[model samples]
Target: MPKLHALELVPDEAGQELVRRDWQALRDAGLPSQLDHRSPTNAPHVTVVSAPELPEAAVDVARTRLGSLLPVRARASGVLLLGGDRVTIARALDLDDDVVRRALAVRVQVPDRQHVGWLPHVTLARRVDRSSVQLALDVLGHRDEVLTLTELRRWDPDLGAVTWLAGH
Candidate 1:
């Protein structure tokens, strides 16, 4: 099976703590955790860019070019509502100049934010009640956080297999 291409960010200590707290709070507040809660499966990462429906060749190209761009620090600002009650409380990401230029270079033919306006976020919870929005917000509060991104890791979402985009 084919897998989507994503950039995995290695979170700093503070970022890690924030995610941990958020995960626990969401569970306590009667919501299920997102995928990353299983440490063995996924790491906490801001989706630098995601493009759907690409050929195998493009993915191979992405894997090659991702390392060309130096690692960037992605900061989180506020909460993003992914329709219904699916919400992600986030720390902000300041897409650096090096990151910007290379993100474009590495951009595939996906008709979305892969080209512009990439929203970087750490998901707090997913698929909770609309009535529980405030509860989720209350748990997250107004947290200003900074996550330093190092390398982009290509992952097989279906199989939960990952390869580090380190050396070209």
Candidate 2:
């Protein structure tokens, strides 16, 4: 079976901690119960690239491309409504050339033109009702947080998990 895999920017320790606290706060503040199977171990990450499946060589290619790159600064600033029912507040991160090049190197048949356009973002929540989304937005309005991209991870299909491949 082909695995669904993605190359994502994993958050550093401080960022992960902040995300955990924020998620807990969001849940505690009566945001609608949206099921998130991900954990602090998984935390939150911005996808650099994704593919249905790639050859083992692609992993090497990704590693090689990512090995020498330095970390970039990213920030979360606005709320995005994906479709009517799905909503998320996201942080926008600056995309470096190396990140884009590495993402493009991975072959993925993404139909979303936006995805192909090198827009990098990390989602804070999904499956959120309008009221909950609005509440989140109100809570997080104009808040700025700095996050560091610490590692590159691949979503392994066989294991149905994300694994650390390389760090820069």
Candidate 3:
């Protein structure tokens, strides 16, 4: 299937540093895809909305309407287990509920996505074993950091590309 347009939060200094730190921890623990920012999928981000496909016009409109919300204070906790055994291990992040609403208001173009009650997070590892999860917890303990989200990003999953939308 062709990739859809996905909107995401691009983190600032603190967040990026956190990602780098986390990546190193994972690498030290002999995990896969660590410090692999060269791959878009491995890049640090928190996706806001994803659709099968999106129009260029809608993206531009969203840029204009949601531009001011940039530089959001993104907060994340240390370790969060998102699924059952061999599930996704992630760090929890939160975007404002209202902002999420506006993003979904445009989701009519793309269906099969549940925008409400969304739990925003940055996946540290996916389908990891129990031992790996413990290693991650041991490496990265419970911590809090503020991520200054200066811009929203448009991600193309199939192409592994990201387009940054300007914000002030």
lDDT of each candidate versus the true structure = 0.60, 0.63, 0.68
Best to worst by TM-score, what's the order? 3, 2, 1
lDDT (10s digit) by residue, model 3, range 1-168: 546668776777678778778767877788643464466455677766676776776576567655556767767855677667676667887667766665555454445443544567777767677667777787777888666667777877767677877552
Q: Give me the runs in candidate 2 sitting further than 4 Å from their true place.
A: 1-3, 32-35, 38-41, 107-114
Candidate 2 lDDT over 96-132, as tens digits, reads 5666777676534343223445667776666777767
- Candidate 2 achieves a global lDDT of 0.63
Q: How many clashing residue pairs appear in each of the predictions shown?
A: 8, 1, 0
**Per-prediction TM-score, please?**
0.72, 0.77, 0.79
Indicate the TM-score of model 1.
Answer: 0.72
**What lDDT, from 0 to 1, does candidate 1 have?**
0.60
Please state the error at residue 33 of candidate 2 in Å: 7.4
Candidate 1: where is the Cα deviation over 4 Å? 1-5, 35-39, 51-70, 85-89, 109-117
> In angstroms, what RMSD does candidate 3 have relative to the true structure?
2.9
